[model samples]
Each structure stands twice: as C-alpha cells, then as structure tokens.
Target: MRNILTFLQESNDTAGAAHLLKTSAAPVTGSSGLSGKEIFAQTCVACHSADGKGAFPGVPDFTDKNGRLSKPDSELFKHVMGGFQSPGSPMAMPPKGGNTSLTDTDIQNVIKYLHEEFGS
Candidate 1:
C-alpha cells in the first residue's frame, strides 16, 4: 500500500512503462523509447486528451474505471494492437491504436501509462 503509493508518486513509472512497451525481444533500428507521459502525448492524448476525458464520441474517459487500464494488460494489448470494433464504440481503435509501427513493448508502456494515470 505504502509502496504502491510511493511508486505512483514517482515520476519514472510512465517512462518505465513506455520502455517496457517499445522494446522487442529482437532489438530493431529506428526504435525510440518513450516515457509514459510521452507515450500518452504521442498516442493516447489525441483521443483521451490531456485531462483524460475522451475527445471522440465513443472514447471513454480515462479517469473512469471503464477506460484503458480497466482491463487486463493482455486484453488492452489486443484492443490496442488489433483495434476496437465493439458496438457503441463507432470508432475502431486502429492497429496499435493508430501507431501501426508500435511494438508490443510500446503497447505495454502505454498500458503502464494508463494504469498510472487512471488505475486505483
């Protein structure tokens, strides 16, 4: 509990998370690692916005429990990597959430960002 809160309060969780997401088992060129905040700005902020409220109609408020970190990491990865086509969403999540070039690590990093930003 104390540890969790301390971890959350630290600034690097987002960077750690993004680093986890961007790297692949095989190192690749042109790969740039980002912090959680950077990942959010580059990828999620467009739809989710800075305040964590979604900009699009179907986009959920990140501050809400139903948003990105609400699900398991694997599930979020699937939704982010494959794209969301669920009913009421109107918009597709797009492969890698529109970052088609993102590695699995990148997705994980973004998930980490979400967890840090929205999870309890």
Candidate 2:
C-alpha cells in the first residue's frame, strides 16, 4: 500500500523506523507495555528483521531451534542489555541495538516475542 511505502521512505531518515512503529497500534506483550514486535520495530529491526534472521553475517537466525533460540532467556536478556559480539561476526550488536531509550521491560518483551514468533 502507499502507506507502507511512505513509512519506508520516511523511515530512511535519521528517525529510522522508530517513528513509524511508535505511531502504530500494536498489541502489548507480557508485562512490558510494548510488544516484542513493537520493540523490535523500534530497535532491533535495523539488524534483525521480522523473521528473526539478522542482516549481517554471524547474526543468528531466531527461527533455527538449534541456534540462538536454544540459549536460556537469562543469557539472551543479558546479551540484549549489554550487547553481544559473536565469533566471526564483522561487528557487534550494540547495547539495546544502539537504542538507549529501550527499558528493561522492553527488552524482555522483545525476547518473549522472539520466542513466541520464532521459537519452536
């Protein structure tokens, strides 16, 4: 639709997709006010798309049960909070995907969203 195209083009600016996501009406997830999909749209989508597959090399695929999803939630939480660099990765994932505005609950919600949408 024209709306999606508008959003994609506008989102190319400094604001990125955060502006579009913040303005959308998505259901909340878990105790976090934002759904994982929402948080992802705001933060992670730059590198991790809706499929849970990353944009760069060494980015783990969420849909792969034997991959990153196998890690415990606590570890994933820590990685999201503190940032992570996988071996052989060209770059590291900055803390909160470089979005400092994200809160603890938001990270939790995104992780849960990953599990629900991509985990087996």
Candidate 3:
C-alpha cells in the first residue's frame, strides 16, 4: 500500500490512491486536522474541479445558483453519504464521493465549505 501511495504521489494522481487508502475500514490517524478546503482539494477536486464546476457533463455545477447547492444541508448530507442520482441527469454521485474513510464530520465540513465557497 505504501509503495502504491508513493507511486501515485509521484505520478500526480494522489487522489486515486488516497481514496483507496481512505476508504479502508482501518482507522485513519495523523490527518493534521485538515480543513474542509484541503479535504476537498485532496478528495474531490479531481472530478468536481477546483472551481466547483464539475469536470464532466452530468456532474453538477456547484457554482450555479440553481444547482445542487440550493438543497438543504440534510438533503445534501444524505446524498454525500449515501450517493444520489440526479433527476434527468445521467450522473450518479457515489457514496462518500467514493471515499468511505471520511467521517460524518468530514462530510459536514465539506458541506460547510460548499455553502461558504459556492452557495449563491
């Protein structure tokens, strides 16, 4: 696992391997209390993009006022934790954005970041 992580980091694909390590059931420690922004950069930027404009067609544009950010936190949290298929769109959000290692708090922090950074 360490070698895989090293290789991913060297190849600038840190998120892929990090997601694998993070989703494992083993307890994760020494995270340096990463803030929501840092967490998003590390875990979400690959698909969501740095500006919250999703990288693919079906991925929601978070910066859009009429987009997913309009939903309440409860709804958003559920979607983030359990995954969601947006109506009329082919995109499907994987549970925990495909990172099961994230705690509820981590998800909440990301939600907060989304509202603060992209909410209209």
Model 3 residue runs over 4 Å out of place are: 1-32
TM-score of 1: 0.67
Q: What is the alpha-carbon lDDT for the whole of candidate 2? A: 0.67
Number of backbone-clashing residue pairs for each candidate, in the order shown: 6, 0, 0
> Where does candidate 3 have its weakest 10-residue lDDT segment?
23-32
Report the lDDT tens digits of candidate 3 across residue range 95-115.
776565678888889889998
All candidates: TM-score: 0.67, 0.71, 0.70
Best by TM-score: 2
Q: The CA-based lDDT of model 3 is what?
A: 0.70
Better of 1 and 3 by lDDT: 3
RMSD of 1: 13.7
For candidate 2, the per-residue lDDT at 28 reads: 27
After superposition, the stretches of candidate 2 with alpha carbons farther than 4 Å from their true spots are: 1-32
Cα lDDT of all candidates, in order?
0.60, 0.67, 0.70
* Residue 96 miss distance in model 2 (angstroms): 1.0
